[model samples]
Target: MNGRSFSSSVRVGNWNEDVSLDEDLLKDFLEKREKGELLVQRSSNLNKNVLQKAELSISKDGFLHFGEMVMLLNPENSEQSLSNPSPVYGNYTLSVNPDESAIHVKSHLTAPCGVSASSNVKPCGRNAFIITSVDGSEPGEPLCYGQNFALRTTEEFMGHLYLTSDRKSFLKSSKKSHLQEVSLTDQDSFETCWQVVYMDPQLRLEHEGLPIPANTKVLIIHSKTNQCLAVLRKYILWTLFGKECEITAHTYLNGHRVEENENHWIIVTGNPSDDINTMFDRPKPLSEDINGS
Candidate 1:
């Protein structure tokens, strides 16, 4: 998904740089706004930081594309050079083929996924997540419950990961979840862009109400604030058919840690085995301090 480009006249704006969008799509967007069919959400400080660094846009033909969405996972209140603050390292790319209705992901992080052995040069594993639309649906269409397929292909399409509307946490899925992808126009499909963050441990646990320990990470959607958390949990569910489990999520709150109307969720990683309960019972947290240097 490198070197992706956008039409100059499309309705959606690019997050990273100022680009001319499609004229017709822009006109339609204006008409929709005048009719109250389109609502532009105000950007937050977090949104500003991300928008300045990443490129995200929606095409007139309804294709959503993302270019270079990145976040520096530095600790809060850390003193460092403006030119060189060390960031927690991670690389994630989300993309899809035009002829297919599935969303494909390539994720690599500083933390080890345990499924692969580490090397001194590139220690972590290269993992993937695939969310195929439900059955009776054509390729390049939105995914639905019971209609989605997984593991049928050679690729290891894993479990469900849901992002909250507030773009704070990514929730793991339950056995009976209807994992569907939310399109740029709020429709369900393969087109999506998420923001990945390395949060402060204390803040993540306190503000998001998650037991993130130290190394657990998350990703968010770009541009649109209210995109549906894709229901790709079908692959995860299918892969993890039997095991002890617990759901986890990152929920975003409106005010300075307000409790009312707060949004949160919990999703499980699909890598656990039959001995998962025994594994969690020990609770071996990572040894290193991830609160960026």
Candidate 2:
């Protein structure tokens, strides 16, 4: 105590080294902390707002007039946010049947992707159904397209329509099988008709009835390759009587309007000079159905 300078200390109170920096240093540290908290709060708020506004985004429907996507509007600046392309919706399918009775539609929804389908029943005249279906392989909301789906409708008259969707891979294992069936006839008839309908692309008839029968309500199809080739109509039966015109000439003479002794069904008629020649004649009698399995 006599030789050395002594230092006197009472007691040291609690002091944190980190908080006990110089005044300027302390202020700078506090500012940095405050700024970090502010940034986190702002980011969180932006995410909440974006989620709330997602429905208005173009991805659900389409792009807005300003060319901004819905999901990207509120995302914090990032690479994905900058280079993102516009949004797109998913796809679906719809189809109908013949005889104006049933319809089918389909769509799907998965963990990462979803789809839906619906359809409308309709009167598919003359032609047979081939299990017309829709496919939605793209992203976003599901939509559909038809086999003969053109912007311009090509038919004498459009009939009843049905809409449906069977997505989610829940309905059937369609993804597993590529083979499908389109049949309007009894199973027993499939074998006999397959020769006439399936194997033959031209529907080769073995000197058979061209106009079909009244009981023949549907043309059996393979549910694929629905094309327009041979044509048929009920009124064409009269043309057959032309070969018998000489035989039925007496009947025609009596039954036809005696004004010119011609067969006039509707309000229209052309010259009766061999008008029957314009119609196709049966090279063979239309007596039996086709042959083969």
> Where does candidate 2 have its weakest 10-residue lDDT segment?
240-249
Q: Best candidate, TM-score-wise?
A: 1
lDDT of 2 by residue, 1-293 (tens): 34313222322332343234445686876785676444445444333321221111122232111121111000011332356432111111111112201111111111111111111111112111111112222233222211111111112222212111111234432121211222122112211111112112244354232322111112222112332111111111111002101000001122332211111111001112342211111132345524310
Total clashes in model 1, counting residue pairs 3 or more apart in sequence or in different chains: 27
User: Residue 63: error of model 1 in Å?
Assistant: 30
RMSD (Å) of each candidate, 1 decimal:
23.3, 30.3
lDDT of 1 by residue, 54-145 (tens): 11111223221121111111112222224335422222112111111111122211111111101111111112223232234344442221
lDDT of 2 at 171: 44
CA shift at 250, candidate 1, in angstroms? Answer: 12
TM-score of each candidate structure, all chains considered together? 0.21, 0.16
Off by over 4 Å in 2: 1-29, 33-43, 54-293
TM-score, prediction 2: 0.16
